[model samples]
Target: MSYDKTIAQAARTELERRRSQAQETARLNLEGFLSRCPRAVEIRRELSSNASEAARAVVSGGEVRMELEQRKARGLALREEYDRLLKSQGLTRRDIEPQYTCPKCRDTGFVEGRMCDCHRALRRSIAYRQLSTGLPLESCTFESFSLDYYRDDPAAMKQMGIIFRTCREYAENFRPNSANLLFWGATGLGKTHLSLAIANAAIEKGFGVVYGSAQKYASAFEKERFSREAGEGTAGDLKNCDLLILDDLGTEFPSAYSNAGIYDVVNDRLMSGRPTIISTNLALDGLEKRYSERFASRIVGGYAMLGFKGRDVRVQKLNR
Candidate 1:
């Protein structure tokens, strides 16, 4: 269960904020309660003194058992009086205590030296939100992808059904070293939709996924080349994410730098044995011509090719 460092840090920061807010609220509640009832303050002081005296009795030794018993009785009496006073004021202990969002960990993101489930959930949510920033992740789930679009053509419908099942199974069983995937076909044939669907599943399973269009990535790479600070971390993220989805692969503006950038990212991930899913409107020959023979060969040899088949779903929808 690996997560991006930035995402883990963000989760920690959020947990810290929750803890602070809970503590602050608790302090204000206690302050207000003490202000309303002066007797409660006296009882609180007596309870503290009783605890100190019990500790001293243990160290002093003579008649320690008896002295400790007396102090314990005094402390219990003080607590009972405090509780009765709170009841009179229509309050309970919880009303003056910190109310943490995750009580099991007290908003600390951990329990007994281990990461809590709440923390893991928070990281997954943050990762998903970050990936969905410019993408339609919520709408591109497997359940929402309709086979009805290809119903008119029997051949197209059969092919799409198999492709859909394969993509869903791949996502369900995805691992760090899972096989790479290439989605190749014409526009609006459900390539990008399935790619994002896979991304959504991988993220839900706690894998870091970087998803974006090839054009967007190319622009980031080109900006990084000229400016030292621009997109400094973008290349690293692209290479290191557990799953990378490069959508519309042939849509980027043609340039030497963008070509090299795309090649580097694809080659690096392949060499590292990390899984990647790329959707392209280009075929083998088009990929070879647009990038290079080597780039095309790497993808062909390493990726499980899924050739999308169907009329343009977008066009079909618009016409309808």
Candidate 2:
């Protein structure tokens, strides 16, 4: 499934820019080396001329084998002499050669016209950014999460403590399609914080993680009804991402269309063995009522529901 076109384009453009940068640096280095070692430069020209002459002899049905052997010996001698000169000047052959970031692909972001792993990794990061465009990511990491806010309530404090540790662990070990999570609780319980923390982890691991509130996603999906390219069909992006975190599931402007859309997404991801983290204020029965039993049933069977039990920490923070 395709993500937002702009994001994909940005990733491609960035990778291309990196590749171009590598190529330019290599070219400049080669030019400098050739200028520094005129003898090595002459050797390269002779090697090229020998290759051309050998090709002509082969096509003309002459004894190309003897010519190829002589050229190979002459080229090896040139290479050895060049190396000796470099060593005498406190340099090495490596210093004079074009240095590539990925020698297999020559920093071209591809090999044999197929996408390189580095390019795919770039796309994954861009995909994550596309989904979390509006998220306050830096502010919601494990470090930023404050247990001081819930200190007044012993139960809340304990729950928050455990939640923090769990989230930290989750983030530390997160992999692609690792585990499904359900963040079920009332509002103001830091569901979004933990969700973003997980996203931070997945991003660190080079996995494409899509994170957004259900309200925002629902609106984007609806807007796509009018414009096909409205925000990368956020649903498709969610469906295909390495990890999906949908926050405030029941808080979206509920409608038949939205409900069906949510069900379709949740079900499809589950069927494909993709990991999705759904944070909802609604309880289990509420989920059953809002969507069909099928959606809830899928969650029951597939997801690891993490029940968040804590009073409103935001209120405690304000009072303190």
Leading candidate by TM-score: 1
Instruction: Tell me the whole-model lDDT of each prediction, alpha carbons only.
Output: 0.90, 0.78
User: Model 2: per-residue lDDT, tens digit, 89-173?
Assistant: 6676565455666777766778899988877777767766665667788788888888776776798778778877877887898
Q: For candidate 1, which ten residues in a row score worst on lDDT?
A: 226-235
| Cα lDDT tens digits for candidate 1, 272-291 | 99998999999999999999
Q: For candidate 2, what is the lDDT?
A: 0.78
* Displacement of the residue 17 alpha carbon in candidate 2, Å: 2.1
| TM-score, cand. 2 vs. native | 0.74
Off by over 4 Å in 1: 1-6, 112-114, 230-232
Which portions of model 2 miss their true places by more than 4 Å? 1-8, 25-47, 50-98, 111-117, 124-132, 226-232, 292-294
Error of 1 at 197 (Å): 1.3
